[model samples]
Target: MTNYKINMGRGFKATTLLLVMSACILLSGCAGKAQTGTQGNAPAPGKGSAATNQNNTGGQPEQQKKAVSETEGLPSGVKVQKVLKDISLKNNYHKKVELLTDGGKRITITDPNGGLVLLNLEYEGTILEVSGRKVTVQLDHGGQQTMTIPDNMTIEDDDNLGLNKGVEIEWTVDADGNIQNVELDD
Candidate 1:
């Protein structure tokens, strides 16, 4: 009889310990998940985190969305301006106009408020013929162009980069379609 009582006490203690352990595990598992409150204002379905527009029902604050812009990171009072082909810049000069000729016609940027400006443009072709200061080139897409090589034009490559037939080249042009500079394309 004494052995039976001893065994029963031990079994009871083991059962109590198991129940406590199970309760602790269940509580710990539930603690990791977020819980929504039922008191205050909640957002509508598919709108935000909480339920329908019930305030005070709380969880976390809604995160603000970031705005996107193409002209982001540009200096204040600066803007990008695009110029079309065959447009003259003689009458549209800006105080801080910067020209970039990287394959299309030259572009001009003007700050209506007289601020800084940047213009991007380009043209590329293969040398077809070179006659004195005049060089004829076959446009990259599908056209023929004749540009006058300037006296001080810099060749941005080694001596092997000659204006010969089949040689690809990139150049910046002025408002009058004159070649301002040339670079050999590898």
Candidate 2:
């Protein structure tokens, strides 16, 4: 094996030059990608890394369906992979789905239709209050959100499938955070 050494003894001028060069290279690459993807160039992402591989695969759904199946406890026939939770909606209830890639860095999906891959997420929360089919959960983002409970459900402790305060609930949800299926965690 060969030994490599980074010169930590470099002066401020060298460091500054290195930083400027890096900035230029990154900016140039970003400009190229932005030009290809956008009309006016407001700095949106170009082709996504995760979906481009599966979505553009000769117009096939088998590989996409297979990938969506890996997500645990998703609803049948629901092709979304993750659903973001929020206290309110943007663009009139239009929500965003995020996927973890590139060493756990999250990339916001630029594609509206990600083929069979989607953002059907499962949220884990503590039940703050419950009444009928309505439930309020203390979300992972440090706020409470109210959602409607699905009819066909299984509750771990409550055989009646009725939600109660202080219980932990894991729910399969859509991009809007609406509960599609739910079960008790404890």
Candidate 3:
């Protein structure tokens, strides 16, 4: 009878030890997997990482200068008298860009996803004449050019740039010759 009792105690101890060992192994494996899963969701490499990969500090500034100059190129017959904004692909992101030669033109281009991307081309000019949808403007660089106003263009005359002709104004545009926005220079 005593021997049977001793055997029962040993069996219970062995089973308990085995269960504890199994549980420990399973928990460790789950913890390792959880740590690895978090890495997959980490944010993408930031701008600093890109710079580090270049291996040369001088190279970074050269790349930035090139980017700014790439967009600074002006089309034929277009002159930037007062640079309102230095636009580049690194700065502007829009479907179409308009370069306004006249003031008192109000057009707003917005991105619903927020203003993460900026597209602004502004120049100062004087209104030469307003004839229906077309307005002739004397550019700062001593040339007169006419721009057609879209019927859907919004006018915000807070500065009264659009009140009459012969007003000095600031305007914004896109890559194409379509006006995006306009306002008083002051």
lDDT of 1 at 81: 46
- Name the regions of candidate 2 deviating beyond 4 angstroms: 1-116, 154-162, 175-178
**Candidate 2: residue pairs that collide:** 80-118, 80-120, 81-118, 81-120, 82-119, 82-120, 82-121, 83-121
Q: Write the per-residue lDDT of candidate 2 for residues 1-186, one digit (tens) a residue.
A: 212121223353466478678856754665566557647533223233445546565332223333333333333433333443322122111233433221111112211223331354556678787777688888654456677756554333333334667767666655454554466655
lDDT tens per residue, model 1, 92-124: 223222222222443433322222233333567
What residue runs in model 3 are displaced by over 4 Å at the alpha carbon?
1-57, 68-73, 76-119, 159-163, 184-186
Per-residue CA lDDT of model 3 for 28-78, tens digit only, reads 664466457667553332222344436645433323333333233344544
Q: Estimate each model's TM-score.
A: 0.38, 0.36, 0.44
User: Given candidate 3, what's the lDDT at residue 135?
Assistant: 66
Model 2: lDDT of residue 41: 33
lDDT value for model 1:
0.45
lDDT for each candidate structure: 0.45, 0.45, 0.45
What would you estimate as the lDDT of candidate 2? 0.45
